[model samples]
Target: MSSGFDPLHPRELDLPMAVPLRADGALVDVTSGEAALTMDDGKIFAAPSDPAQLDDWRAQLVSWREGARARHGVPRRYDDPASAWAARCFTVAQVWLWDELFFDFDAQRFTPERFLADARERFGGLDGIVLWHAYPVIGIDDRNQWDFYDVPGLKQAAAALREMGVAVFVDYNPWDTGTRRAGDDATELAATVRRLGADGIFLDTLKKADPEMVAALDAARPGIGLEGESKLATERIADHTLSWAQWFADSEVPGVLRAHWFERRHMQHHIRRWHRDHSEELRSAWLNGVGMMVWEVVFGVWVGWNDRDSATLRRMLPVQRGLHAWLVEGEWTPLAVHEASVFGSTFTHDGSTLLLLANTSDADVTYRPEGVGWQPLHAGDTADLITVPARGIAAAMQVTGTEPAELDAVRTALAAETPARDASFPHRRTRRLAPQIPSRAQLAPADIRAGATVRTVIVPSGEHVLTVRHRARETGMYDGAPYVDEWKPLPPRLHDQRTLERVVRLANPVRVGVAEVSAAEYALFLDAIGEQAASRDPERPASGVTLARAREYAAWVGGRLPSEDEWQLAAVQPGFRRRVPEVWNWTESEHSDGRTRFVMLKGGSAHESTGSDWYVDGGVRGPEFALKFLLPGLGQDASPSIGFRVCWEETT
Candidate 1:
C-alpha cells in the first residue's frame, strides 16, 4: 500500500499518470532531464537533445500523483494494484545483488540466460536488486578498466539481469589505473552508461568534477542513474556542488540514485570517530530526494568469509534496526543533536523519540535521560540512572503523552523481551550493589595506591572484616625526623613510652535515605561541608582533640573501606551529593607495587601547615582524614573524584 504499485508484472498496462506543474503553472515532465520547480515559481530546466524520454517522465508523474492521492484518502482516481502487492513492493525499497557473473573474452563465452537465472534465484525475492559489476580490476590501468565494455560477456550479464524483472546498476569509480582516466570527459562516460541499457550507475570516488560530470551524463541519458562515491567529501567537493548534483540528478532524471554516500567502516570505530559529526548530514541526504543505501553490515570482501560473529552482530543490531525504523517505517521528522560525554545517538519518529546510548569506555557510564521518562530495553529495569557497560549500547524509546505508569509498563515489557548477556571477568569478583548492606564475605581485597584511585574487585569468599590503615609521616616542626622539635613532637616521642594506650572505635552510623541522589544535592552537600569547615576556629586544636586523638581518628577511619559495589550505588544517588572527607578510610587493598597495605583519604587533613590542603587541591592527596565511600556495585574507575566513607557492622 505504501508503494502504490505492483512490481510482479513484466510491464504495466494501465500505468497511473500525472502532469507535473511548475510554480508558474507550466507543465513539466519530471522524468525528463530538463525542468526543475523552484519555490518562488522560478523554473530551471535543462534542454536535452533526446526529448523522447518526456513520455516516460509523464507516466511516472501520473503514478506518483495517484499514489499521493490515495494516501490522502482520495478514491477511484485510477485503477491500482491490490493493497497487498503494493505494500510488499514498497517494503523492499532496495536490494543488493552479488556479483557472481564471470566474463571470458578469449573464448567469447557469454551466457545471459545463466546470469539471469542466478539473479532471480539469489535475489529474486527482494524488492529491487542492485548488481555489482565485474570484479574490481585491482592492478589494471584506468585506461583499460573500461575494456570490460569491449568484452561480450559483461554486456550479456547486464542485459540478462534487466530482462529478469530486476533493475540493473553498475559500479563506476574515478580511481586512477582504472577503465576511465582521472580527467575523462563526463559527457562521454554518461553516454556509455545510457547506451549500455543500464538502469543506473553507482559513482565511486566522485570528486569535485563529479557533479558537473553527472549533470552532463544526465543530459546524455535523461534517466540514466547518477550515484556518487563516498569519498567525494574527502576530496573537498564544495557543499553546493554535492547538493546541487544530487538535487539536479534527482529532479531531472528518474533513474538517478545515490548509494554508499556514507562509507562502510568498523561499527565501533565509526561511532567513535564519525557518527556524531556525520549522522545528521547523512540523514538529511536520505530525506532530501535520492534513495540511500547502506553498503555492508560488516566489513569483509568475500561472502561469509569475514562475517560478523554473534557478539558484534548483537551490538550493532539495535543501531541498524533503529535507523531503519526511523527512516523507512516511521514518519520522517527533524531531530535535534545531543552531545553526550559518553556514547549516544538520538532521532525522532512519529511524535516519539529514540535515544540510543552506547558505552564505549572501559568503565560503565551512568545515563539519565533528560526531559523524558526512559526504560532500558536491554535491562528490563526502570530507573532514572542506568549503567551501561563499555562497548555496550542501550536504546530508549520515549513517546509524547506517555504517562509515568505507561512508561513503567514499557520498561517492563522491554526488560522481559531482552535476553541477558553473559558478562564475566575472570580476574576479579563482581557483585551488583543495591540498598542492603553487603555481607562481609562478599568483600574482596582490592589494591589501593597513588593514581590507582578507583577499582572494581571481586568479593573474596568467606566472612572477614577488612581493616584499612594510612601510612603517616612526621611533619611541621618534626620534619619527618625523630623527635627533635619541642613545639610539636611526633606522636611516638611525645607520649611516655610505656604509659600511652592506643584505642579505636567506629564513628556514628550514617543515615541511609536512598540508593541514589541527584547531582545538585551532591554538589550542595559538598558546599555545606566546605562552609562548615570554613567556620571552624583554627586557634586551638579545634575543640575535639589532642595529637594522640587525631592519630586514632586517622587510623580508625583509614583502616576499612567499602567494596566496589557499594561505591557504585553511592555515586548514582538520585538527589544527594556528599563530600566524603573527615575520616581517612582504608580498603582491604594494596598498592601497585604489590604491597598489602594502602590508604584512601577523604576530608582535608588536620595538619594544615603540612600542605595537606595544597595536596588535595592539586589532586596529589590520597584518601586521608576526610573521604567519601562509593558503592562498588555501581562500577568503579579513576575518572571521578572518589575517596571513601567507612561503615562498621557488628560481626556475629
Candidate 2:
C-alpha cells in the first residue's frame, strides 16, 4: 500500500486506490493492467490483485521492515514522522553532478544513498543538514525539463531521506535553463519547491536578475536557508540572507555540507584565476560591507589519486573542526580585499578582529597590521609576538579583554613604563634656524628622570647628543665650513628664519618597539625625507641611506620588528590610520612553504618605489634573516627609533 496522498488540485478531495488482491496474497495485478494507485502519507507499497498475492505482499512488507531494522540498528517499530529536525552542516557536489550527468545508479559512484546513509549514521545527532545544490547546467538542452510536470520519484526520495532525519534542498536557478525559450517564468520554479515540500532552496546564477525574485523568496520563507552561489553580491542580499558562496562553490554559511572535496583543479582555478582575476572588482563592491568575507572550497565527492576511488570521501577534519564556530555561528565583516600577491582579508566579530593574511607572492611576503593595538601570541613562545612566513596563511585574531590576566599584567607593566610618543608629522612645518653657530650639547643621564614619560626624548629635557654636521659650500674659504663657523658672524644662535639641521641621539637608547609603526609616522617620515632629499640637487641622492637601513639601525639599537597590526595601530595613534608606506618592519612570525617555515616582514622595502603595488607592499623572508627579540617585559631594548610601546587590551 503506497501510503501517501494522491496528486490533486489544492481544492480537490482525496481518492482511495483500486488495487486488486491475489489468492496467494500477492500484488498480482500490479503489472497486468493500469490501476488507480494511492499515496497516503509518503510510503509506497504494492496493491495486490489476487487474495494469495495480497497475503504474499504482506509477508514481503514484514521482511522489508525487518531488513531495514537489521541494517540500520533500529527497532522494528518506526518513529512517527520518522524524521527529526537536527542541525548539521554538509557539502554537495553540484558541479560534479552537473558535469557527470545521469549518475550511474548501478555503479554505486553516482548514488547519494551511501553518502546520505553514512552521514546519518555518523552525525545524525546534529540539528540540520545543509545541502549545496550546485547545478550550473540546469537549463541545458539534454537535461531541460520545463514542461515535465511530475517528478514524484524525487519527492519520494526526499521524503525517504527525511524519514532518516535529513532535509532536502535543491539548488535554485534564477535564470531559465538556457534552452527554456528565453523568458520562462521563475515563479513556476518557486511553486515547484513548495510542491516538493523542500525544506529550503539555495539561490544560484543571480548575475543580473531582478531583486524582486529574492524578495519574493524571502516573503515565501523568511528564514528558509537562502544561500547565494558564485559571485553574488552579498551586499545586495537581504539581511536575513543565510550565506554567500565564496570561491567557486564555497558557502559563507556554516553548518551546511561543504562542496568540492576532490576537485583540486577547480579549487586552484578559483584561488589562482577567478579570485585572482576579479578580486579588485569584488573588493570595491564590498567596501561598504562589514566583516571578513567567507568563501567555499569544494563540496561534493572525496579526494582520490585519480577518479577511480570516488566512493572514498576524504575529510579535512582539522580545518573543518577549527572553522566550525566561525562558519556556523560567528558574525563577519569584510575589511579590505587586495589583488595580485596577497589574498588579504579582515574580519571582526564580538570585539575580536581576525586578519586572514595569505602570501600569494613567489617570494614570501610579510604583512604588518597597522592602526590597531595588538600583541602577538605564539603557540609555545612567551613573546607577545607572532610571525608568518612565505606561501602561508596566518589567522591572526586581535587580543581583547578576554585574554588571560597574566597577559593583561604584562601589557599593563609595559604601558606604565613606555613613554607616549606622537608619530604624526604634518604636511607643512615652520623651519627653525639659528643665527649663530650652535655648540655641541651632551646632557648627562643624571639630569633626566629615569621613569619620566616623554613624547620624544629630544622634545622634552633628556640626555641626548646633538650632532652638527658641516655644511657644503660652492665657493670661498668659509663657505664649506661647519654651520658653527658660518654662524660666527651672527650674534644670537637662535633665529626664526634660519634652518638648522640637527640629529639627536638618545644618551641611553630607550626601548621602543611596536608590533608596527603608525601610518602618520610613516607618512611623516616619507614627507620629511622627501623634503630634505628634494632640497638637494636632483642628481644627488640623500646621504643618510635608505629606510631599510633605518630599520636595520633600529634593530641594531635593540628594538625588534613589529607585526602588521602593531604597525597600523602605531600609525593611527589617538585614532586608527588607514594607509601609509614606510620601511617594512620585520615580524617574529614563521610559516610553512610546503617544506619550510619562515617569518613575514611587513610594509614595503626601500626598493619598492610605489606603495600601491600589492607585491612590494608587504614582503616575507626565511628565519635566517629574521631578527629575534625577548618576550615583552624581558628588559631588552635595542633600537634608537625602534622603541616599544604598550596597548591596553579591551575587555570582551
Clashes of each: 69, 111
Error of 1 at 464 (Å): 69
Q: Per-residue alpha-carbon lDDT of model 2 for 1-652, expressed as tens digits?
A: 1234221211112111222344474444332123211211111132333333434544433343343334333321112122111112333322222112212222312333654554333222222233333222121112233333233244554555457554555565444333334334456556655665555555553422355664565455443444444332212222222333333221111111111110100110111111212222122211211111211112211111111101011111112223333322334332232434444334454555544444433354545565555553222212233333233333344656574333343333223221111212111111221112112232113312221221321112233333222111110011111121111112232111222333433233232232333323333334533433222322222222323333432333223333333333244344322112223343433222111112233333233212111111112221122221111111111121132222222122
Residue-level error in angstroms, candidate 1, position 526: 94
Tens-digit lDDT string for candidate 1 (1-652): 2243322211121111123444464445432233312111111121122345444433443443344333333322112221111111210111112222322222334444554444333222222233443222112112232433444344666676566554555555454232334346464456557656665555544523445765676566444433343223322211112211221211221121121121111000011010111122222232222222322210111111011111322333333433444433443221122224243445556566666554434455677777765545566334477665543445665667643333354344344233224333112122222222212322122322110222222222233332222222221110112222122222443222221121222233222212111233223322433423222321211212211222222223222344322332233444423432222222322211110111223333322222121122212233122221221110111112322333222233
Off by over 4 Å in 1: 1-143, 149-169, 173-188, 195-202, 219-341, 362-392, 401-652
Tally clashing residue pairs in candidate 1: 69
Q: Report model 2's TM-score to 2 decimal places.
A: 0.29
TM-score, structure 1 vs. true: 0.30
Quick one: how many clashes does candidate 2 have? 111
For the record, the alpha-carbon RMSD of candidate 1 to the native fold, in angstroms, is 29.0
